[model samples]
Target: MLVTPLTKLLGIRVPVVQGGMQWVGLPPLVAAVSNGGGLGILTALTQPNPEALRQAIRETHKLTSKPFGVNITLLPTINPPDYEGYARAAIEEGVRIFETAGNSPGKLIRYFKQNGCIVIHKCTTIRHAKSAIRLGVDVVSVDGFECAGHPGEEDIGGLVLLARAAQELNIPYIASGGVADGRGLAAVLALGAAGANMGTRFMCTVEAPIHQNIKEKIVASNEQDTVHIFRTLHNTARVFKNKVSTEVVAIERKPGGAKFEDVRELVSGARGKQVYETGDPDYGIWSAGVSVGLIKDIPTCEELLARMEKEAEDVIDGLVKVRVEKAKL
Candidate 1:
């Protein structure tokens, strides 16, 4: 059986994790991943309020008796949801695993630990990972520049970033961004990561709640089909290369950079939700990673995970054979 620090920590059979994807991490997909022998995460803020989040968690529990997690991304907004309330609800609902992103959880990390929850913080830079470690997170999920959504301001790819993490991190950590197949899983494991956290790959799965058209677009698009917006604003986001995203880039390139207001209407979260619900890929700006190129079909979560596990086994065995030949030389 494939196993690692992550598998042991999360009590799962495989080391694959479906990272939280906003608007996509509903119960259907989350439960599927957990049932398939991987960790699945539900997006907290995707619910309207803390109460809604509690219901979502309960619903996921009904779907799968296996372990699943909740993702509560702390973004800086004018009016924020009750972060503490959300944590309390998850704790009350018996959720023991959490994936936090965007901003640091600060004292909430302490609260979660106190409540017997395993905290996994997602970050893009080694410095940020160190900070989370100091803050007492059980695990760190490091994202590379090839990741969707916010990859931070650093442009480090998984190859160098993960190797660097292997060298520096003290606790168990996972590799996020651009990992779509078993080869990617084998690569990260070789680089010293405990597991692989996949967002785009999960999004393209049959169990993912997004529309099939969006999945098809991802399968058809290549690595270069993604463009980064808000680079000038210092909060760059990787999104699918569509008409709306291209226009956002065009506006960002012209003059002294684009303001949030300049493209606010175009990048609306509601519109992105419509794209997912309506199956119109070009209807709005949606997030996707460079791993889109690696996706070719929409398979069930179980099928996908089983294939990845076999592929990883084969790759590792092939590498061992290569090492044996080298030793003979």
Candidate 2:
């Protein structure tokens, strides 16, 4: 297979990027992904402070010399104490890739670029992708409606969004959302994407820090097991079907339904942190994409990569045979 711009830019053998999922994208998981020939991402906020992030980076380096990235979600709730300090620390740690989400980094993008980091901002819409490209980001991860963790209100799928981005921008982009296996990877490549960014799929990996209960739940799920909630607040998120999510949807459907603030309290970030770490599903919110249903087992990152490559090659070979038969006919 031909290497895409994403592989070239990230200096990875495979174009797959393990999404910077909170609680999940830690040093162990990140190192596993990178060692498996894919780009592993460390969630910057997973650490308590910049020094912690730097320490985690060092640890990941010790595990694998492969290239990796860091994700820093630009959200309002983040403590404003040392956001820039964290960025600087990551740069000093020799982290070359930075992934931003939630809001535009704007000037922060420039600062990272100045420090020799290749920025790849995640956006759910074409407009946002354009803005990132204009800001001189090396690449963009176009997250579609199927993605977890705040998949914008536009509800655009990767197919339409990637086409739009490819037509409008000259920069390379990877398709995120609804991507789980090699078939999904090949599909995105067919849709004009260079590669795919995966979150839920990586969560099912053995290296992920989530509890076994959570991993098992993902393996048993299907496409219909996901639902989008909090649309009223303009912060729609695709999550697994759980007691909390069911309640959120039930409330949303009721006449004169509860206010966003009310539900917001029920699904607080602190609560989510606990559920994700402890596997107490009913305790709080758990952000997951519909792709969770497609995941079947908790394979190691290396195993997953090998399977994906084999499957992708087989799929491509089958397609080539079909074309040859059609020509003969």
Candidate 3:
């Protein structure tokens, strides 16, 4: 088995992590990933309230005894959900791992650490990763420009981003973006990431809990099938290239550019949730990473992870052979 700091830290057998996706990170998917030897995460805000999140946690416990996590995204909202209450709910329910994203994790970090939780903060830039480290995050999930959802303002892809993180950061980190296969996993490992955190890839799994049509849409799409919306508002989000998303981009590029208010309805969470339930690919703006180009089939989490492990091993072995041959000259 390929062991890394991430595996050791999370007590997982593989270095694959299913990233927390809104609407998609439910119990089935999360439990499947954890049972398949990767760390799975539920999106806390996906629950309607702290009580709802607590119930979700309890339900997940019924599904798998393996390690899983909850993602608590802290964003600047007019009426924010009770972030502390959600944290308390997770802690009370015996969740030992957490994935925090959006805004500064300063306030939440202290409580999570105090509870003996292993915090993995997602960052779009090395600077932000450094700040998270100072806040006592145990690990960093470095997101690249190729990631879905909010990839921050920086446009660095995993190539330069992961390498830069390896050069500067002292703690263990995982690569989050454009990772779909064993080759991608091996590449990230070579670039100094302890593992690869995949959102788009996991979305195509059998237990993803989304409509089959959506999974088929992802399989049929190439890397270029994605577009970035809300770039003008400076909270650029990478989403699938569909009618709704295309229109959102057009509206953003209008005369004086646009604000969040202008495109709010188009990118509403409700609409995105409908796309998954109704199986309509173009019904709304849905997040997807460039890794969509690499997904060819919707395999079970067990099947996918097994294949990835073999593929990563083969790739590493091939690299070693190449180096040995070159050294003989």
lDDT (C-alpha, whole model) for all candidates: 0.93, 0.85, 0.94
Give the true-structure RMSD of model 1.
1.3
Residues 50-151, model 1: lDDT tens digits = 999999999999999999999989988999889899899999999999999877587788888888889999999999999999988999999999999999
TM-score of each: 0.98, 0.95, 0.98
lDDT of 3 at 304: 93
Question: Model 2 — TM-score against the truth?
Answer: 0.95
CA lDDT, candidate 1, residue 62: 95
When summed lDDT is taken over every stretch of 10 residues in candidate 2, the lowest stretch is: 320-329
Candidate 2 wrong stretches, greater than 4 Å: 78-81, 325-329
Cα displacement (angstroms), candidate 3, residue 303, comes to 0.6
* Model 2: colliding residue pairs: 221-293, 222-293
The candidates, ranked best first by lDDT, are: 3, 1, 2
At residue 264, give the lDDT of candidate 1. Answer: 95
In order, how many clashes per candidate?
0, 2, 0
- Who wins the lDDT comparison? 3
* Sliding window of 10 residues with minimal summed lDDT for model 1: 320-329
